[model samples]
Target: MTRMRAKPGRRTPVGRDSRDSLRRFVEMLAEKHPPLSLDAADLTIKDPEQVRRRFGRVFGYLTRVELEVERNVLELRVLMPESTETDRIFYEQVWWPQELQHGVLLDAAQQGFGMMPVPIDVARVSARIRVTGALSHLPGMLGVIRLLYYLTGAATERSAVIAYSRLLDGLRAMGEHAIAETVIAPIRRQEPGHFAYYRGSAEALVKEEGLSDWQLQLARILRRRSFAPVGVTSRRQRADFGDVARALHLDRDLPAVARQISLVEHELLWAQQLGLKVPRYIMAALDEAIALSTARSAAQSVRN
Candidate 1:
């Protein structure tokens, strides 16, 4: 575990309001939700070729949704202690199964389009994260790291909500109403609550603890470097993400999407965001991924 020497700041009390909010989220979890029957019959693509092309692109990256839960659970168990048990419970009991089911449904949909699903290797928490987790056990460090976790979660889930919204629109426009209704809508619906949880948690923590400039900078740097769309973990995932963005015509709106995702961080990190639409680092990373994907596809075509 990488032991970080964070200033020993006073512990911010996790107040009753935060606990109440978590309880509300807990009460909302349903064991079974929409898209309950995602077999081959559920796919309503009028053109299977487009389905194979477009829906396959979306489904190809759903594995990250599942693997990330594993990483979150492992990291949270280490970083979140007794006071933050509600956050941990929500992830384990509510979020994990919901996200895993998303992967399953997307896989089924992709298979219906005659696309082979990529196998997901569930990620174990790595030594570096474990070390960071251990460092988070310290008093001053724990609060800051926990705040980062919530902030990261907020940004990520907000991005997911936006992507799924765009995807739902694209599917509906293509006259795939069944998918728009059953698969995309339901999954997107659940994401807002998760985002709300993280947003509320972050707001509360930040209000209570108050961020130093150094803390804000750390948050900015971490988010700038680490933020990736769902299912983006490797070079291949980046390519897949880029392919999906292009297929869905999302390439043009990425700046807007990036801006929306960075709202909280912008407020935290910059004074009036300094006229930045989105962080340059994040935009650069996305551009690089798209270029890589294009190059890869071109190379494969030449080989064929």
Candidate 2:
């Protein structure tokens, strides 16, 4: 007869402590990032073709990332030895579909520009490889793995909101009035809900697991290494930052870019919520860049 190893003990169901902490975290995130109503916003597209093309490019990138996330979540489910039905439902039914919606909204917007949506196979492959590698060693530690997952999710969703807000604000300042509501509005609407779910889930896991200081530190390290801003992986996409600056009629200098970065820092609520140290030199550099940009913009305006 073949010998079989005994399975490990099941984790306790998420208890009151976890639930209460999660509730508080959810409230905190909601307060920090207020939800904007798309219905109330005017979403008219002035230059339908231009707006469409931009949507196609941006959505094409987003679709890939979403697919990868989906694959990663799936792997987690498969590899997990024990999971509560509630947790399973949240992952498979709720979170998965919500992420897919982000891509769907972008796809619909892309179709408006007369471009064909690319298949998400590339994203699928990349996700499978990366997630497989990450979770390969933690086959049975689903709870801990999930805690890490949700924390990264929280950070990523927040980054998306910050990036979209800036993009929308830039478009409005550039007189590309209609694209803000029509193109960016739907994407933004879905993001808050995504952020809420992950933030809530992460806080609950942290409290339930009674994560140690080392665990939290490990989580942060993992998040910083694996996480990236949505649709911002390449030099080409980075160049889109310049396009956004140009659209706003902002100076396309290093200082202007630094100012944009500063805005990102503010939107993230870095010092207060993130509680990370920003080097003094970095802050000084940002100040100097802002000054230079201001001087250059003034010089150009006077000549004109």
Best by TM-score: 1
The C-alpha stretches of model 1 lying farther than 4 A from their native spots are 1-16, 29-41, 79-83
Span of 10 residues, lowest total lDDT, candidate 2: 3-12
Off by over 4 Å in 2: 1-44, 49-56, 67-69, 78-84, 122-143, 170-179, 231-275, 278-304
Tell me the tens digit of each residue's lDDT in model 2 across 1-304. Answer: 2211112442212224555544444444345534333344454456667655444444455556665556657555654535555456556655566566555555554555565775654223355445644664663345556665565556567656655676677557556666566657656766766666665555455544455545555544554454333433444444443333333333334343333333322322233445344423334433443344455557779999
In terms of lDDT, model 2 sits at 0.50
Error of 1 at 178 (Å): 2.1
lDDT of 1 by residue, 160-190 (tens): 8877888889888888887678777877878
TM of each candidate vs. truth = 0.83, 0.55
**Clash counts for the predictions, in order:** 2, 0
The numbered model that scores best in lDDT is 1
